[model samples]
Structures are given as C-alpha cells and as structure tokens.
Target: MPIRRGSDIGSPARTRSRKKSRRLWTAGAIALSLPLGLTAAAQGNASSPFGDEPELLQYEEQFLTLYETIKDPANGYFSDEGIPYHSVETLIVEAPDHGHQTTSEAYSYLIWLEAQYGQVTGDWQPFNDSWALMEEWMIPSADEQPSNSFYDPSSPATYAPESTDPADYPAQMDPDVPVGEDPLADELSSTYGTDEIYGMHWLQDVDDTYGYGSACGGTAGDPTFINTFQRGPQESTWETVTHPSCDDFSFGGENGYLDLFTGDASYAQQWRYTNAPDADARAVQAAYWANQWASEQGNAAAVAGTVEKAAQMGDYLRYSMYDKYFKEIGDCVGPSECAAGSGKSSNHQLMSWYYAWGGALDTSAGWAWRIGASYAHFGYQNPMAAYVLSTDEALIPQSPSAGEDWGNSLDRMIEFYTWLQSAEGGIAGGATNSWEGDYGTPPAGTPTFYGMYYDEKPVYHDPPSNRWFGMQAWSMQRLAEYYYVSGDERVGPVLDKWADWVVGEVTIGEGGDFQIPAELEWSGAPDTWDPANPGDNAGLHVEVTAHSQDVGVTGSLANALSFYAAASGDTAAQETASGLLDALLANQDAQGIAVPETRGDYSRFGDEVYIPEGWSGTMPNGDVIEPGSTFSSIRSFYQEDENWPQVEAYLNGGDAPTFEYHRFWAQADIAIALATYTQLFGAEE
Candidate 1:
C-alpha cells in the first residue's frame, strides 16, 4: 500500500526473493526465457487454463488443499448453489480458530472463480461454505447479533460495552463487556502463544471449517445471488489474455473492464496471459487494469461507468474501484527486487480507498502494491473486479497530506506489506495518523494516533505517526483478488504469506471472544522503533470489542484463501477460509450491510466509509465498508451513527451508491489490499 504520509520517498530498496541459477542474459537477450502464450481456446483448458507446466500442477495442488479445507459440507445449512456450510453457532464455539471471517471478500472471490472455471467444474463448495457462515453470523445485524470475529465483538447482538483507550497495551478480553455474561465470552478462544502460533491456530480453524462435509442448507435468500461479482472467466479477465501486447493493456471499456483510449495492449496481458490463466499473469494484469482506469478514465467517465456497471452487474453496491494494477509490470513478476515503477509504492492507494464507487468507499491492503494488484480479485460487488483493481492505482497521488513515500519499505510506510501481524491479528508500522513520537517527525509533517476500539472500548492504540496494526484495506484485498483473476504467479506466495501473518493475530479464545498474547508486543521499544528514538508505536494490538485492524486483514486473507484453495487445490487454505467464513457469518447481520436478496445462505458484510476518512476504506467500485474521516480525530470511528442501514445495504450490494467522493484521503488504503494479500498467502483467497 502507499505510504500514510511522512514515510520514505519513492521506492525503497526491496529485499530480493530469487536465486542466481538462471543463465545470464547476453547483451542480445531476446526476452527468450519467457514461455509461449496459450491460444484463446486452449487457454481455458481443464489441465489448468494456464497450461501443462510443473508450476501449474503445484499451484493446482495447493488450490485443491485450500479448497478441501473450506469446501461446504452435508452436515449443516446448504446453499442452492450446491455449496455446503456450518452454522455460525457451531463454527464459532467449536472451532478453535479463525474467528475473523471476511464476508465481502468471500463473495467477490467465489463469483470470480465460478466465472472462470464454472463449465469445466463450477462447484464453489469452498467459497459457498465460507460465505454461508459469514452471511449467517459475522456482520452486525439490527438483531444485535455478535460475530465470532474479534474485531467487533457484539455491537448489535450482545450490546456489550467497549473501550475508550485504544492506546493501552496488553488488553484484557472484555475492556467494556462484563466477562462472564458476555454472549461469546465462553465460546471465543484465547491467543496465548507467539504471534505465529496464534495465526496457525486461526489457520487451523479455517481448515476445520472447510473440512466439514455439509453443504449449505439453501441459497434462496442470499442477497448477492444475482449480483455479477465477476465476469465470465472464459474470457480473459482482461481484453485478450493470450494477446502478446496484453502485457501493456489496461482493462478499460463500457464493460466493467478497462480500455485506456491510449490503447496500451492489456498491460495485464503481460500479467494474466504471461498466459492469462497463470496466477502471476492475473496479478500483474489486475495491477495494470487498476492503474489504467484511474489514470485514463476521467472522473465523470469513472462515475458513470461505475454506477452503470453496478446496475448491469445486478448489484447496486458493486461500484467502481482502482484496479490496483499498472502498465509497467504488465505480465511478469518482479525479480528478487521489483522493477523501478512496478514495485515503486504509488500514492493512489491512500486516496482511492475512500473516494471511489460514488459514495461507496472503503479500502484494503497488505503492503506495497496493495491497491495496485488486488482490487479485481477482492473488490467485487459486481463483475467489474478488474476495473476496480485498476482504479486503485489512479487514486494514490491525492491521499491525505504528511504521507509517507510510496516505496519506503520499513516502519510507517513499508512495514506492514512484508511484515507480520501481532498476537491479536494486528499489523504494525506507521499507519493511521503521523506525528506523535517518531510518527510526528515525518520529513514534512507530524503523525497522529489511530487505534482500534470495540464495544465502545479501546483495544490497541499507536502513538502519533505510529501505527501498529494499520494497513491499506481496499488495495490489499484487491491485489489478492487480482492474483486470482489475472493469474499472476507471485499471487500464490503473496496471498499465503500475508494470510499466515493475519491468522497468527486473529483468533477466538476458549471463551470465544478473541485474544492477543502479551509476548507478541513489539511496540515502543528498541526492537520495534528505530534506535534513534528508542520508541515505536504501541505493540501489535488486536481486540474483539470494537474496530480491530484484523477486520480488514482477516477478511482479506479468508477471501483469498477460499479462491486459492479453489485454484491450487489446497486443503489448508480451504480449511482456513471455512473457519473465517463461519466466524464472519456468526458475526454478521442477516439484513444489514450485504443482505441476502434471496435468503438461503450467505450474506455480505462491512460498512461504507470513504478513504482518507477512516483507517480502511471500501472496495474500488466505491462502496464504503469501514469507518472513516480524520485519522487522528477520535470521533471519526468512535461515534455511533445511524449509518447501520447504509452499512447493511452496501454490504448486501448497494442499490444506490453516491460516488461523490472517490477522492481517497491519503491514509485509506483499502484500494490496494489484493496485491498485498496475494504477496503473502499464495493463490488462496
């Protein structure tokens, strides 16, 4: 994701992730090492649309494994779509991990996967199962239900009290809610080990959820059933995946895709078609699409296209998004070190997360290419995943002031992308606001504090300019989704790695609320902060009471995990997705946010909040999922407003989005989630 102002400038010297075995390129290098392109017809073959290479098999197996973990079963509710699912009740209390299920993430990815391989084999049991749980429980409903997700413990369901000091470290489970009487206090588990163990446990929950063999009971009232979250996968997510120039194409057109009038072949062609069917290709293309749309599609065009696309796709919430793509890196993965611009942190992520999608704005992100890579795969309310991914890149430059340098890869700006999460599923670095402590010493500005609160109580807090669990929301999820749709190779590991981190942080205790071990604290110390100051932001703080950083992260990982399991055939990812699905379902509001239109099984979640306003923003199509407004202003996310209906409506796919503020405020990083998530979890979500 782009920096939150005051970070290093330009790109940071990245850590190399390759070897030195390939033959050296002679002065006359013919770009010969690349593989041959697959024909359009052959591209979608059953043997992996990307083709017969060894890597395809590897990814396929991985996908299968993840799928197995999350696929629906026969023991619980089933969706007419033939997907299996478990009830939030059992999913939460019985499951020992993965309480933070990402509702919106699951739906978007399932739609894309079905679009791609439906005919050959289109049973999204994995996605469906996960979706069922999320829909049933995770979202905050008017019924005042509580999700197993620790992020927002029980705003509506139980109505427990929340915290007022997000800055406090080493939090107890119930900062506000009375412990013994709390609704989920008994079912929620505890996070009592190294952050890694906590994450692994959550991962285990995801595994178990998918392993359940019961199919979702029905799909009758599923709110987003008819919404075209993804386009026909038969066609390349871009214009022409197999086209050689695709490396340069920027998905654009009257369709939810992209077509920069300048006509760069599908910049994503290089991405997805590096054979469009490949994961790497998809990741790269998604980034290209996102960048192109934002840069070339003027605001008026963007607004019209977004609203029209939402209508066409059958979802009022599926607006426009920054694709999280770029033209420079077309279809190839970055070398151990990324290309100058391809890997260079762009500012669009910060500004775009909150402003796109008419009045629907929210964001996601893992790190770096957050907005530039994941919008399509993760930013779906409709079939325009590719377009939203593209839009992510366009909104960077306008983020709130005092932002960090896009490329700087440490502390405030660069930390979260490649870094790990804390015991409570919290991320670290300088997000939220800048100025306090080292955060306040930006090259040109001061930092502000942005911590999470739950049930009206504080969970984690960072010093001014210091963010511990902060991330680029919309962008992070979008990048992961892009990896799946565009078929980018790096998509696999990227998604996996990040998921691992988030899993360690978000988990349920034996009591069922959520937990964060004290050992995971890496805040305000020499190891955490720079030595010059001997101080950093607060430790990695994740809580279940109010808004937790994991709300953005856990959801993104789960969504990607579901998809990757589908693509690579990985059971682990599948299981993880299932656990997340269940948790999210238990926490959701039946008719709020993403209300199931029909009502069988499955419901989308999240509230609408513009970028630059809150810590996280909505998807690229401009649907606000998270809360926003003035990062440092405690009142921003602290107040209890009457936007509940808006949140539900948007989550279930808004019918009337007001895209008047597609101007992401530098900090909202939702636009860049996919790329970031993909960079970590492999192809899962």
Candidate 2:
C-alpha cells in the first residue's frame, strides 16, 4: 500500500504517489532551474477535474484540522465563548491557546466550505455541521425578540441550551434607572466608559454578548434586554440580568471586539471593528445555495430555514451599506462625509474592518460612532440572497428593509464596481484609512470632541491608497456573475474593462515567470503627517510599490477571467484566462504540497527586527528586492532566528509559507477560487 496520512483508505492515485514530483523554479531567478520529476497528471494519469483527486482530498483533510483544532470535543461545539461566541453556556470557557473567535466572517466561510465539501463528496456531515453552528451559536436567541424571529436557535437536535429562560443569563443591571431605557446606549456606555445615556436600567453583559445585544437590542425584540427587579436601594444594587434568548449576528453590529488599551504610549486607544464583506457575502451565498442542497436531500424545513437565515443576514448587511457619516463633530454627516466617500469609492465597497479611536473617525462623542460600510469584495453574495428572499416570499418573513428588491442588490454591486475601478485601469485594495495619532488638535473645519473623557484623540497612519489584483480579480468574478444573471448592458462594458485590466496587470514572463504585481500605489501621498504631535495626519505621504504575484491573487484572477471570457465570448480574455490557469497548474506541486503562497504568514513570526533602509535582502540571482519599500520609510522584518533559516529556504525556493501556520483564511481564499474555477470550467480545457 502507498503511504497514507489520515483516512486515506486506499485511492487509485496512491499507487502512483511514489512517481509524483514537481518542477520547482530555481533559487536565483524566476526561470525554471532544474527538472524534479513527473507531474501529478503524468504520474497517475489523473482524471479528476481540478488536478489530483487524492491530493485535493488530502489538502481538504489538512485544512479541516484547524476546525478540529478549535473544536471542543468535550463541549460538543466550537470553543471560545467570550469576546467571540455569544453562547449563554457559562461552562464554555475560551479555548486555550486557540485562535480568535469565528463570529462574523468565519461563519460564512465555513458555510461555503460545507456546501462545497458536500457537493464534491456525497457527504452532508460538513454541511450539517456548518448549519448546526449557524443555528446553534451564530444566530442570536430570538425567544424574546420578535423582530429577530427570522432565525431561531430553538431546535433541540442541533442546539441544547443550558437555560431557556431569558432571565437565566449572567448580567448586571442598575436599579436607579427606569425599566424601559435603551439597552444599547447603556451597554455601549458601560462597556466603553461613557456616561450612562439611557435613564432606564441597563443590563450589562460581557463582551461575548455585545454582538448579540447589538443585534437584539438594535432590532425590536430585545431578548438580551433581561427584565430585572431592583434588589437594593443603591444604583448598583439591581438584580442580575439574563437573556431570554441567545441573540448573535441577528442585528448587524459591525464591531467584532472591544479595543482595550495595549499600553502603547504613542496611541491613546485603537478600536478595530471587523466587517468582512467577503465572508459575510459568501455566507449569504452559502445560505442561498445550501437551501438548494437541502432541498435535494429532501429537507424542506432546512431549505426554508437556510433561505430565511440568509435573508436575515442580508437584512442586517443593508444597515451596514454605505450611509452618511454624522458630521456634527459627532453626528451623522451625509453627502459631504459619508463613509463611502471617506474611503475609495468601490461600486460595492465593503471594508474588512473599520478602525476607530485612533482618530480614524470623528469620535468626540464616543468611540462607538456608527458609520456603516465596508470595503468591497468581488464575490459579494448579497445579490443572490436578495433574489432568493424575493422569490421565496412565503417561506421567509419579509421586512421592508430585509425584503428589498433585487434591484437594490444590483445597485449596490454597481456602486461598488464604480468606486473600485481605478484610473489606472486596475481596482484598488480599497482605501487605507491611516492617520497619525500625535496631533491632539483636530484638523480645521472638523468638529472637536476634546472634552469627552472616554473619547480619546486618535491618530491615524498614512492612508492606504492602492489597487490590489487579488481584490480586483475577485470583484471581476462577481461582475461576471452579475452580467450572466442580469445581462445588464451596462455591466458588459465594465466587465470588459476589468478583463482588459487583468490582462495588463497579470504578466507571464520568460521561463514561466508568471506574476502579477500585488499592489499599485495611489497617485499622490502626503510625505509627512504631523509626526511631531503623533495623533494627527502630520504630513506623511508615502506611495505604495508593487510586490510579486502569489497563488491567491492569481487563482482569483484565473477564475474571474474564465467567467468573464465565458460570459462575454471574448476569445482574447479566454486565452489570457487559460494561460493564467496553465501557469497555476505549472506551479502546483506533484508531491501534493498544498503550500499556496500568501503575503504575510511567516513574516509575522520574527523575534528579531530586521529594519533596513532600502532592500531587505538579495535573492540568489544577484537581484535586490524591495517589497513595498516606497511608502515604508524603514523596512522591518520580525523574524525568529531559529525559524528564519527554514523560512528563508522556502522563500528562496519560491515556495509559499507553511500550511499549518496560515490555515483558515489563506487556505480558504485559494481553495474557494480554485473550486470556483473548476466549477465554472471543467477539466476539458
């Protein structure tokens, strides 16, 4: 029998495993240096579409390890409840040494992956597991909240709640305040050290419940608003509050976690709110498709449930769409300072995260300035969700905001693409919102929040203004889908423009020097932000330079271009897409190493700081490399000395970082793109 890792249970490709080898690019230059051995296709005469079935299966198994790693076998669910999960179960302690909680974005990724896994193999376990997670832990408790009745986590099969009563959850309330005060305002004040805004008694829960509270309280059925009686006369002597239902992600609160002071003297406070459009969008997509999968399995309830769940999220996402920023120094500022205009205007602009407290936004009133919007991703699935919800009117309870027409979704996409398309014919990676934090003074014409105790004067870094091919490629894929679905005449030209953009950006050189510059800089960057003050944009303007192509960006482009070509009947686009695919295949490891290149996995592990003026190091080819040194005044490499040797060797060999280190996200991006490519165009070249 051939060597097996786990669950290998004899595969036909196993017989030819010994013969498999890959041709690696030589260390010196981009040229192919030496012949290693036979490729996977040559070794097994593989018949699977994407590449080798066994190899892909192995990669899948390896990728699933992270999920397993984060799982709590004892608890029978994922670990890490606080600061991440909104489970009312008190025994569910945070997983030891585990990664960050997969609340907002990871939920969608897992949903998408589960569907893909089920499609490939005749197994619904992954899909079932993913759905169970969404049903059990992700969706907020809706027992008390009528507005959040769309996705109820009341099923006994998947979720076993320790306490069903709303009064059972552990929370504190103030006795002096009235009973009907706003829970959201009180919660925000208590959490962020602000004045108690509401006169009604506030139920203060832990961080885990913030997202749930934001969802439940922001919406109508405030399940998290536990009704408590006063136990004592003093203000702090109110009875403990407990949630009637588990509410998480039911209402869209973009902030993921609290921004605690890290003791960094230069920064007063830094609050980062993660709003991954790609993750959230894909989750919606998964829900739309998962319903179809469920229907195929003869689960009508699941079919309806999935669509309703997706619609709920889609509704929440609408609140997060581009809205006017409050300009009254602390009010909703529209037309002039909408969050959409503050960032680069991608047609469907979706930000992964919005950082506040660092002077990124005008937060003089408080750090919780609610300006909703995110940077855009190409494969936004909100449109699909809208279509599904609109078509299946009876299955899901329609909200005026949630049940918006498909036209609304299309317009969002149009807006994103409009903002994303650059003058350079490439789509930027969205705007970088960085301001220097030194200047305590606010800029002229801006409202000042100087006296607020909890609100700290924030300084931002030099704003990121550049285009990323990876993001552009992903956007192209979404555009292609939109065109295919709507056949909108306007989208056709935009699609063609993006196709041409890809052709210009993606460069295939001599001896398989296939590469795409990772990023292109903005036209102008102010050189010096007020470094003297340290809290404001002093006067720093740095332009971004390009970096080498990686598998993720290339894979996305390959898939998008393939879609565009097929949709438009553009032969040139088709040819370019084919070449890109061929290049990707050429780069694949025959030995079945799933080490897809990512930009930043190994570089983060450095204990020793390697800060240089210009070039970090030289390649074996006698060529100096400066990866994004233009904007960066000083180069810094935080590398662990012991691990540097191995990492350096991998880099020299033009190999990607190790899989175990960057599993969830980096793994998913490439896997999803490639799977999508295969789905779009079968192996028949």
Candidate 3:
C-alpha cells in the first residue's frame, strides 16, 4: 500500500523556509569577510581559491546554497538508504508515475551533481559516495539475478510482435522466430568473472509504494525493482499496468504480470531488469569529469575506484548498441525475413532505448534471457561519455573490445547527429533496425541510416518522443561538451548552427521572467544518408510551438550555451547563459528552483486502462484490475495522495491542478549549470 500523506513512513521531513535571505550570504558580506588578497581577487585583480570575479564568487555561492538545500534532510530529496527520490514531492507524476519512485536518470544526475560539488569545493568524498549509493541500491545484486549463468549465447530471447495499442497485448511469444547470437556474453562473463550484469535497472519503487517487496524475496519498505512502459509506442504512462521487475506468483493475477504483457503457454517466477543506456552513460560522463576535476585538485586517487566502476558499466552498456533479439541490422521487412546475426552485424554502434536481461527465480529451472533494443533516438547519444570511455586511459574499460567499440560508437554518434541535423539546426528523430519495433516494412522513400529506417519519433509516441524541447537541450549539451574537450573540427559547425537557433528561440524579459522553447513541432524528414557524400538535409526543420520557463530545461540550455561559448568564443551564447542562470536564481524556493506547472495531462487520470475481457487481477494493494478499470482505479493508492483532492476536483469539472515540483534531476541540473558557468566563463572579462 502507498504510504499515507504526513505519515512518518519514509524519510522524516524537517521544516525549511522558502525565503533565501536566511540561507544565502550577500555578495557585499562575502567581500567584507574576505582577506586583503582575496578581496582583490573578488575585484578581478588576481585569482583566489574560487575565482577572480565577484560574479564567479556569486555563482559559487549559489551552487553551494543549492547543494545544501538538496542535501538537507528536511527537504526529503533522498531516501533513508541514501538513494535520491525522483522528487521531494510525493504527489507528482511524470515519466516515473509516482514521485517517490526513483529512476536511474535521477541517480545519474546525483553523480553529476556531486562531481560538480567536488570541482567547486575540492572535496571528492561526496562524489564517491553518490556513486556508491547508486551501486548499492540501483544495480541489482548477484543474488537478485542468480540464474544468469544459464544464459545462452546462441539464443537470446523468444520474439514477440510489438504493437502500438495497449489492447493488442499480451503479445504472443513465438519461439519459431529466429534470434541472433549474443556475442558479448561470454567475453563479459570471462572479463568480470561473474555472469551477473553490473548495470543499474532503470526504475525502482524506493519506498516500496506498490508493496511489491524486493527482488528475490525481501520484505516491503526495501527498494523494489519495478517496470512500466512495456506495452508499446502508443501506451502512455497513464495506460501502464505497474508490475514488479522480479515477478513471483505472490502478486498480481495468476502467472503474475507476465501473462498481461506476453502470452506464453506457461509463466515462471523470474527476475528481469532493463538498463537505460543514456543514464549509465551519463554516470560515466560524470565520472570522467570527476576524475578530471580531482586530478586538477591533486586528488586523483579519491575518485579512482568510482571511475573504474564507471568504465565497467560502460563495458556492459555495449548491449544497448545491438538489435533487439540480436537480429541482423538493416532493411528487414519481416521478423523471420531479417536474418539472425552471428556477431557484430546486429550492432548499431549507437545507444538505443534500452537493453534488458532476465532469468527464472528458481535456479534449477536454468533459463535466462537477454535482449538489446533496436531503436536509437538522437537524444540518447552522449558523445562525451563515448569519447572518455574510448580514449581516456584512466577510464578505459577492462574488456578488450570495449574501448574500440566505444571509439566506433563515438564516430557513429557524431555522424548520426550530422545525418539528423535539420535545416533549422534542430536534430531530428533517429533510426531503427526493426521498423515499428517488429521488423515491419517502412513506406517507400522513407530515408535510411545505413540500412535502418528513419523514424520521426523512434521510441514512445504517446507525445511523440521528440516533441519536447528538452531533448534538444539535453542532447546538444553533450555535443557541446564533446566539442569543448575534443575541439573536433566536424563538431564546430554543428554546434554553431544549433547554438544560434537555440539563442534565437530564447527570450529574456525584464525582471526574473524568461521564456525558452518548450513544445516543438517537426516537419519534413532528412534525406537518406550517403556517407561518401552526405545529404544537406535542407528539407528537415523544427518549429518552437510553445514556450515556458521550465527551470530544468533552462538549466540544461544554459549549460549547453556555456560549453558552446567557451569553445567557440561566442559572446552571445555566453551572455544568454548568464541571463538564464540569473533568471533561475530568481525563482528559488525552499527545495530548489522550479516554475509552476499546470498539469492538463491529469485529465488522463480517469483514462481507461485496456485490460482484456474476462482477464482479472489484483494489485498488491488489493485494487481489482478488470476491463472497466481506469488508470487511477487500478492504482487506488494514488487517491490517498494529499494532492489527490485537487486532481479529484479537476476530474469533477474543476480547473487543471498546478504544482511546483522539486524533482531531483531538475535541482541537480540547475546547480550543476551554475558551477559550469563559473568554471567556464566566470573570469574577469
């Protein structure tokens, strides 16, 4: 059952004032307190331990203040086990359904946040601790996946046809469908001396809100691995049927949730986990920065252990590059027609949506499965992580082929960006080996990346994955970072065009008000790739259909501009980044910077969840699941949320409810952006 509002069920909430006057030190006060030489440094005369400008000192103060707020026990940003929650507020919903439910994305941000902290304060303990916390809680232990030793390289997983509609499931598992070999399994196991994967699972019910207990039979209140979004592209978070990652007959209907998603003659109690490669890659990116900053501070040994672990994670992340079921890549019209791949033929050399592994709970059953994703989104590629994993000796993977694979991936990723770059500078959606997620035929004239078909929105389509402006900011920020570090000539022109377009969309008004691109509209598609003579993609374009002061995206945009400006010496990008940081600083609350979000999507609370007729189940909380059940009806605990009253009112003819959510990822992004600005452009100019 969900923990009741105001109950002392999880972390204790302490009272914190929203006012900043009590927490932050004024610039005048900071200047007055500094010694003679430090005061001169503040006046832009000489460098101090922080920096040589008052603005830089101010940014450092802002970062420290924000970091403290995030770390404060009263804020409830973290669980008792030291794992960060998705948000401080428990009554919100987004990609993770419940705010208490944590994601690997949040953990990656935590790692990055601490790395920035280490850079600013010359303290690496927090950075190391953050990585340790993620490893301990997010990554499944060996015991949680004991049957991995039974996995076979020859056959990965049985094939199931993917559908756009939730009603089309339970997709039948067809063993007759051919699958390719798992080339990395034996090598990875041999290198690590363990069959178990070292990657973090994408989602976790940190407070056991769903009462699924824990993986491999632990009690409630422990962090429980869970999953959603299994139906298909059309299935939104509202349409999901939440189920434990480690399925036993103890919860849900007979056969657990397996029968609800995939139709098989029988079901087994099993453990499954999915890795969001972008998140793991972000963690590695953070490690690379942490190593760089610590080495600068003469504290390289402090983060050495965590950096090594990040390399190992990157090695395992290679799974995300392969086609789902390891099917041969490119130009396949049917599931069976697509030949099973023997080795690297299945590898896309780009980060895809996810890679998953699973096995039976009863080890004696001796069956396990692994599969990679076929779709590659432009937003998921992290060239910085790829560069570090491939080139940085301190962070190179232990596996022999891992570095070479990443080196190839880095080149492929850059080329992918070039291929997808729109006439207006925005990157378009990505390519898929198995079109429509099941090797379906693409319409004639649909552009191809290598042999793969281009998709306007590769993964989820509930909102069209590329429809949000955040994707541009997040992906381009990594590109900007790569350009900053590598100074690659090919990257400069791409960054110049993108940074110009982004700055054109931004509008910083008087006072603290600002507008950045929010919703986006896309038209036209890129021309088919010819690597020897790449197409100009002049027909592809993106339009900013909406604008808002979304603090998180603004932070990301600011960070992107900071790196681009630092590398290209663009004063416009630098000034715009400064303005954004200043705007964000003005919007501070007790928890972190946030703007009020009107959740019009809450109307989907009453949306019907498609359950087959005569098929029934019970949630762990005892809510009945049947054909008539709505999204909120099956997860009745949501009704117990303190904010549910407003949602109920909205459902009963009231206005849409609004919330100022202090999401962990958003707060960390904002804080890290501040530190980034100081590091890059905070010098006296």
Q: Any runs in candidate 1 off by more than 4 Å, and if so which?
A: 1-58, 61-102, 115-520, 524-685
Better model by TM-score, 1 or 2?
A: 2
RMSD from true fold, candidate 3? 7.4
Q: Write the per-residue lDDT of candidate 2 for residues 186-255, one digit (tens) a residue.
A: 3233333433111111122333222234432344322222211111111010111112122231221111
Candidate with top lDDT is: 3
Residues 504-569, model 1: lDDT tens digits = 555542211332222123332112323244333344343423233233244445555544544444
Candidate 3, residues 596-625, lDDT tens digits: the string is: 999899999998998887788998889998
Global CA lDDT of candidate 3, please?
0.83
| Best-fitting candidate, scored by TM-score | 3
TM-score of 2: 0.49
Instruction: TM-score for candidate 3, please give it.
Output: 0.92
